[model samples]
Target: MDPVYHIPALLNETIQGLAIKPDGVYVDVTFGGGGHSRAILTQMSAAGRNGSGKLYSFDQDADSLRNKIDDNRWHFVHSNFRYLSQWMDYYGEQQIDGLLADLGVSFHHFDEAERGFSFRFDGPLDMRMNQQAGRTAAEIVNTYDEEALARVLYIYGELKNSRAIARKLISARQQRPIDTTGRLAELLSGQKKELTCVFQALRIEVNDELGALREMLVTARDLLRPGGRIAILTYHSLEDRIVKNFLRAGNIEGTIEKDFYGNILTPFRLIEKGLSAGEEEVNRNPRARSAKLRVAEKIG
Candidate 1:
């Protein structure tokens, strides 16, 4: 199998954010295309003058297994990053030195038509990142109640006309199931924003992306040793906001509590302000335009 490629957004920035150390343990939660993972491994390799270190990468997508790194210092886990803690424990690692997560969908997901992640393609409306488990997008479009669909669209996609779009989908699906991405996109042809929102909402619902992200963030914070680091790249505002708040508040709900010393009780300290891909990278990869990178360190 050929190497699957994902031009990692802010590659150098993410590596610098992790502050990789020789002989330290690290985890790459996304592992899409393995570009970022490869770079981290290169920095940690014994021949690179860094002490030998171990790196573990997680990706539920079966397609990603094709790019598995065969080095002794690296390990790949075929699971969602939300289970980061569980898997790390299984490997006898209670805490790690650093963690990196590239949130949201990957390039391969959009480029491959049969995956149905992109509205431009004519394929079954299946948007399962872990293709083997869980329901597909088609199921939600065809069976979810209109109100439920509207909620997903409104919350995940941040679309104001979600109710109207849900009504339209309900009416169309009554005659027949919304079986394909093309048909759904066609129904939304006149409204470009509606089309993008509906597809985005359905993908999030199918994958429970936000839920997984919340789980991953809390687990990552718990699994990191004090002074350990985290770098997250989020492709959409919804994911970005969650990452931002989690790092700021130490919890998904964004509640801040203070310790006796009056310091914020957050589990992590912000490393830097929010950042995005520079102009050159955005020009080369348009998708990087929406990427938001946030880095933080586990608090004392």
Candidate 2:
């Protein structure tokens, strides 16, 4: 694939936020399009004159591996970042010096109509991040109970009209199964404002994205050595909230109660308050508008 797709412009800032050390091992948990991975490699290689540093890249999409560049120092793992810890153990590695994650979906998934990740395309309701994963968007939309569907939209997608949309879907699927992405889109045409939310809910349920992200973060907390930095770029508020809470309180609950001595306890210390793309970057890449970058270093 050509490099026409634009990734987050804060790649260099994210790598530098890691405080990259020569000969240090790094991990790019989401190797989408390899933009961030390529930048990290360039900096790490320049730092280490002998080029002995290593980079471990992980992606659940098998198609991403096809675009892997021929590099001796980098190892690509064809699995979800949720299993970062397992892969680290398999590679006989204890911890990494830095970890970078660009949590946004790759352009390929959205640009490809058949993937059913975009609302612009009329295609099958198939939004599986990993092809091998069970349950497609069609299955959830066609089979889930009205109440469950409403919950999915309300929580994951934060749709205000979730109940109405879920009821409409259930009624529509009763007459005819919601098979294609366009079919569902047509059925919910009355609720056009909630179209993105409905689809986002279906995609989240089909792929269990939130659950996977939580697992990956927990595993990362364990895999990163002390002072090791973890940078996460989240596109949606749901993901950003999780990242923020986790980094600030060392847990997703975001509770920061003080101890008897009035001292707070946290596992991760904030590096920069937040990292965001500049106005110039947003102008060049509109997709960067929704991105929220957060960086933290492992402390406890």
Candidate 3:
């Protein structure tokens, strides 16, 4: 396994929450570095059920193919997690015992300057997770109207000065296209926190992270069998809130419904409500600091 690719956050907690069955099916939607997937494989194999257990790992980034598992029981799906239902159907899997999604950007992405996932590095403003397709961060910065850019920053990054940042980005791009991370970083340079938010906003926009996340969450909910578990590790508030609400209400809107008897109706029973990584783990992996783990079990 590539240690630098990604360090799975709350590894033990997520696995424990999953409570893997010996011969049950599982899905790891974000197979970055295969840390969490490997852990799940370990638990599944420890039961000594031979090859009865099956694990399907999904990743859109072709780069993740480098960390693929060799076990016969482990199948790697080279597709976005949003297509979870489609791929599961293709594989003839109707239900899953558990699903795990770690939404943090891989360490490989941020550390590799050429990926343009971090403002700390000077590179082209290309932040697409799937390098083969989709709009680049440079395109958004160069083409988006001020209001659209500001909306992305405000909604995705929660930047309070989104309008001002968008205006500045527009002005800077007018002089010359903001085609590289260094130029965009220089134009938007400010407090470390704001810079982080700006880059985060752009990356989210480039990848449509929130939209894909919502789609995956819904598919995961439907794919889980009764008593099956779904564990998600979200790095930012926007995605975290969506996970929290979806798990709580068993729907994306988070609207609680009641039966005629006045009992609230939801398809899931929340197991872990925004559990953060422990201090020991955070000390070893600072990226785990922002991670919040949420687990829920499907109710019959």
Candidate 4:
């Protein structure tokens, strides 16, 4: 079963992190369902249109673009947020006041069975976030070497039985291609957690999700103005850890380098540590249960 829509997680916290100014520029890198983008727009003043303020949003999925807010103050870019800074540069914009990113798969993907994001429905194993670009999940399941498959499952899905799962997938595909979500799910089916984990591992690899995230965060660091804030909502440990390290130490490794006077050299200061979705929000949107919000502001 899938949620009705991509209810933006930690909506108030995410928007508040932006600290919207009437005459400021902001960006929502994951404009799924336009939930967060619409909220950002609401906070901006009408007089802050072209001259004073503007909102730019980017989403890799073309389906999400249909939900674009039709306001002069809003601009939608159809590209992965990994190129966030590039797009900003293309727009001739130097820097932005804040950036918001709600990471992980959008609810609409899982809701639409044909997208192959969930095991609840049988469909093509096509887990590409940008449906038109990149390899499908089916390709990797059928083509990746046993060890490579195990690595993806272990690292991304955090599956302890990744080797066993990889072996099973390899054996199943030898008879015929494991080409659909139902077939893949059937072969690896055991515990419900394992089912979801395998599917998640496949989706992350099919889209190079982690790679994109790393690039996006690095670019964001370069693009934010001094005092600018970055609010990110992560659904899994892999994402949360990377975001935490980057925010605190200015790198994915989270290594703190000291300057001449032994001052830790980092790009941003933490505004809020990981804040879980309140019980109320989690009750309304089960997906919010795993959400953890982390915010940081640029530091000199």
Whose TM-score is greatest here? 3
- Candidate 2, residue 241: lDDT: 85
Checking candidate 4 for backbone clashes, the offending pairs are: none
lDDT scores in order: 0.88, 0.83, 0.91, 0.88
Better of 1 and 2 by lDDT: 1
Against the true structure, whose lDDT is highest? 3
Worst window of 10 by summed lDDT in candidate 4: 44-53
lDDT tens digits by residue: candidate 3, 1-300: 444888888999999999998789999999989999999999999656356999999988999889988888899998888899999999999999999999957999998899998888899899988899899999999999999999999998899999999999899888999999888878876578888988889898898898899999999999999999999999988898899989989899999999999998999998999999889998999989999999999999
Off by over 4 Å in 3: 1-3, 47-50
- Once fitted onto the true fold, the runs of candidate 1 whose alpha carbons sit more than 4 angstroms away are 1-4, 46-51, 260-262
Candidate 1 yields a Cα-based lDDT of 0.88
Model 2, 1-300: lDDT tens digits are 564543655776787788887678899988878888888888877754448788999988887886696777789999888888889999988988889888857888888778888777888889887888788898888888989988998998898878988898888888989888778778877355578777777777887888888998888888888989998888888888888988888776778968899988887889866677889888988888777788999985
User: Candidate 1, residues 110-221: lDDT per residue as tens digits?
Assistant: 9888999888789989999999999999988888898898899899888888898899999999898989989998888647777777788889899999899999998988
Higher TM-score: candidate 2 or 4? Answer: 4
What residue pairs are clashing in model 1?
none
In model 1, the worst 10-residue window by lDDT is 43-52
Q: What TM-score does each of the candidates earn?
A: 0.95, 0.94, 0.97, 0.96
RMSD (Cα, Å) for all candidates, in order, is 1.9, 1.9, 1.5, 1.8
**Tens-place lDDT digits, model 4, residues 95-150:** 88889989988889997889999898999999988988999999999999999999
User: Would you list the rank order by lDDT, best first?
Assistant: 3, 4, 1, 2
